[model samples]
Target chain A: MRVRAQMSMLFHLDKCIGCHTCSVACKNLWTDRRGAEYMWWNNVETRPGTGYPTGWEDQDHYEGGWKPDGDGITLRLQGKGKALARLFFNPALPQLEDYYEPFTHRYEDLFDAPAGDVQPTAVPISMVTGEPMNVDGGPNWDDDLGGSDIFARNDVALDGVDQTIRAQMEEIERVVFNYLPRICNHCLNPACVAACPSGAIYKRGEDGVVLVDENQCRAWRMCVAACPYKKVYYNWSTGKSEKCILCFPRMETGQAPACAHSCVGRIRYMGVLLYDADRIPEAAAVSDAELVDAQLDMILDPNDPVVIAAAHEAGIGDDWLDAARRSPLWKFVKEWGLALPLHPEFRTLAMMFYIPPLSPLVASVERELYRLELPPERQDFELFDRLDKARLPIRYLANLFSVGDEQVIERVLRRMLAVRVYKRRQSVEGVVDDATKDLLASVDMTPEEAEAIYALTTLPTVDERFVLPPYHREMSIETLNDPLAHKGEVGVGYLEPPRRGW
Target chain B: MSDTVAMIVFVAFPYAALTLAIVVTVLRWKLAPFTVSSISSQLLESRKLFWGSIPFHWGIVLILLGHLATLFFPATVAWWNGVPIRLYALEITGLALALWAAAGLLVLLYRRLTTARIRAVTTPMDLVVLIVLAVQIASGIWMAVGYRFGSFWSVGVVVPYVWSLLKLSPRPELLQPFPFILQLHVVSFFVLVAIFPFTRLVHLITLPLPYLARPWQRVVRMRHIEPVG
Candidate 1:
């Protein structure tokens, strides 16, 4: 295997506020051309919802990644194979008409109001509905700063709730949901990489970012169907497919990704992760579940001489090496025990990590009211309503920290305001920066209070030598046990071996 | 334009596109081999796509040649020219092969639409080009099998038009009375031409020698610098 570099990203969902700034910034930069209107290199999705194209998360429909059974993994191709092929030999997946078509209105449809016509003019109505037209669904229908349903399903931490919490929910149906501020996970076993008949998609070695070549593209559009993330898009005018470049241009200059750089919640981290170049092929070849451990092993230990030597040999700078140490995976797999992959079953070796939120405020508030023998609903219900109306803080925090609780307002605010130190360049920046202390104070936390929470969680929490299931290690060559592989197809091919260092 | 002339230009455009596409593919292979990034492994994919596209295109050329013979050769002259029945049979068989070729092209297109590698490389214009080709082939087949308009005489104009193009004097009058199917085909054909040079379709004319001139095996300097974070 040749020594080509791979790039990857690790997103911290606990810190993302679902503002569309990143989406707008990306759209303004890359996809603003005519015919590129529908393309968005960076988009925010509301979890538990259908996502942008609708039903994007349903693997059965898209057939993106490999699903493991007993012996091996099966490649599902419901979106590709012969069954669907007969429909359009050069089939166009159902276009806008196949879904709900978007409509725009002509100037004639609106009434011509005079300059001083002030009778409280109402907005023009939709032609289809004859009622006020409202934006229904897109990439982020549920991203209104609240917990989306996706968070609710995946957060398994919240179990066996206390009676005091249940008592607070007596009058309301306290259903819990989650919101995942998703971006390209830059998988170890990228389905788009595997599905390319032309083998055009690749994961970079330096940062693990995935990218596409325009000149070599034959305009096949296969990656569109192969990516479960649906991040890849086709450019009609150019006759080629496009996707997030991972803002490599910005990264090279030592700036964060646009989404990460602009994150209001400060939940993102970017760094150069050094892995064994040799293990990539093996990692790509294994089942998705087994693939996770092979990937975790690739995380470079900064203090390891061999890893340090390999980084020097590979031409990576020390700044990047230092940044790699700060990654959440370095904490979850190497430091903390609680952190886990979002959907280990997908087997893409997704790099993003979430340190499940633990709402001390919510727990404290509920406990104090019960001790005083006061009704749970009477304590600052107005504040609760306002926070609940926004929805995201409650929904996302519940999913990350406390799952299945319907009453999320007070708990969510207390947790959000709990963050104190915002780390930048390995040096700590006070969470109550001059710009945000006012907003921080309103949540009832002093700058000192937020800093304390940051100090507790910043250190490594997971042990580096922690043993994972055998599936996480490199599969034995003799165990070439894929039942679904096309006859002689060997496993994924990797050129470089993992960097071995203490 | 007379059907004969229309057929010639239809056949020639492929030759032009094929020639230019071959040259571009070859030059890029040798000079800018690394210009095609490892992002999607396009070096390997470009080869497969090139081969699939070749058969589909060459098939169209052969099919169009047969169409020209039917339109231009006089029936009496064909008999005196010997083996009229055999020649007519060959023409019919060629038309069938053309339809089959179109279907094969559709298969290739479907692969692009559904596969991740090809799909990522695909532009909306690429799909539009495929859709246009599909429509053209469908309509041409309809016209060949007794689907008609007000007059067959208009087709004679297309023949003259083809001759004029070969002579560098495109005669629009020959195409004025052409049937709807033929007119629709002609108008779409021009639109495809105007956009051909600007698209990946340009590869069709640039890579006729395939890998002989393609430098897919070489490692070259990549164009994209690593993005800093």
Candidate 2:
């Protein structure tokens, strides 16, 4: 089993508050440059909306990600021959308009303006051309469903649902949405690395961090088109594609990435997952129905003796193996089966997993009518059978996280609900009654496991959440050479400092 | 004095240009490798680029191949031109290709000049390269129209001279009889070759041709490359 250590992430969507602290932190670190104002390396997208770059999930228009040809998958953008032919004019590329025209207020104008009856105003100016422009869209234009009528109605996930159900989603009170804060998945089979004509992009084997060699990036912009999540962005000033480096510098020293570390909601979990490298093709090639299972099967149990032996043979150290065993991502994604990859149908085998957010329970007409007939004093637990009527449709979450596997979404949400109900009963009711037991039994979870899930979800320490593996390269460097050898030269400087032009 | 100038332009200058091109290209590749890209402006303005780049690339590529064919198979080209109608067809085709290339070059130049974003991103080298390209294309079109049947006469005269240069025997006098426009084409070409590695023209050698045959997914194996202590 060619075991390889993959550093992965799990986002517990249940806890995310949609505050965009991660977005601002990442922007300040990576993409806050002249040409990169349009790029959001980390963005919190409000789902049930069309996301950044307008209707990105519609593969027919944007054509990002991989397409299943027969058994194997090919990039949905274009094949090799077609790609080379269209190198000059990448028809699939998202234009500046597709992403919003980045603009900033001319704040200096407020102070510069002469005193007048009207208050001094900072005119919005396009960052690209420095011309006055109307602010039409932004990186998070649909935040909290600000422009829900147009943005939410056009979401690609809603396409497969019943027309009436789709219409119901647009209704004011019936609406449901969740925050999907995204960074690049840094997939096992990254289409960006495959599509790069310059062969500049590479996934570092040591930690599986995807990086773009800016010098070699010929501004082909193929990576921008190929990434299914649209995480790779083109910097027009430098004429190159730039993406999230996953904070490898911080990670090497056992610190969480800036975004994860700065998270206010504590939704992000970083960890190591030991996987069978040989099964990547098989896992990614599976049918959409089996995608979640295939990906899980690919993630070898770190505790397994056989897997540990294979990992050792693959040059992995004991520290990394230990980290993998202790990984919160493994428990959330595989052991507990709470987190699932976003859009596994993309066939990129996205390393980032997410726990589908639980929505408020819908009180159906029958349930409410039945409640009215009975006395208020007799009402006790109304949780189990009512799960099928969650305000957010099972089909919608399935479309996003599980590729239309409604059963998968139902089970995850059921488990989450059981934990809450189980915990509330202990704290509020002061006992573990049979009603709570029946609720836990119906979802097939023990009280101990529910308690463990609850502890990790609500009360995890920073160390428990981010299980960073040992950097073998850094360790070797420290032992073989002096850590302070490069001293000032290596501390701060861009290898190839970006400039305007020749 | 004219004989000396001809020798410098035809024999000495061409050799010097080729040597400079080769040495500088290697040095730049080793030093500032990131600069070796045909950085696109399609992100800013793709509509004008489609009109400019497609015709320019396809037309120039075909025309360049045509130039190479005439030089390599001068005897075969002369034999084909022996027929009167065949000669006219060949001449008309060369002129048409030249016109097509020139038109594309004009569109590309105009786009760069007119577009605000494109003008901002453009470098001194970029403007110089475009102007140089314009001169070469304009001179070629001028020669094709003003001095007709260049494809026929060039085989007998220019072919032998160029062949002698390749054979390491200087024959600057043979090209001396050519008009100023014809000489300008040769001079502009060598200058382009000299400045090639510094401009976006380096991307000509950097196209990922292997991508057409390689697998869809690429996983870099850096394990073996690094020295493990």
Best by DockQ: 2
Clashing pairs in 2: A215-B34
Residue A117 lDDT in model 2?
A: 98
Tens-place lDDT digits, model 2, residues A371-424? 222234323443345555566778889999999988898899888888988998
After the best TM-score superposition of candidate 1, give how far the Cα of residue A232 lies from its true spot, in angstroms.
Answer: 1.3
Model 1 lDDT on a 0 to 1 scale? 0.49
Error of 1 at A222 (Å): 1.0
Predicted candidate 1 versus true structure: per-residue lDDT over B1-229, tens digit per residue: 6767655555555346545655755665565433332222222134444445556656776766654654576353345335656645654665676677677678667767765445644667667777777877776667656543212332356556666666666565565565678777665665566555444444443322232232211222233222223
Score candidate 1 by TM-score against the native.
0.54
Using Cα atoms, each model's DockQ against the true complex is: 0.04, 0.48
lDDT accuracy of residue A158 in candidate 1: 29
- Which candidate leads in TM-score? 2
Off by over 4 Å in 2: A363-383, A476-482, A492-495, B79-91, B166-168, B221-229
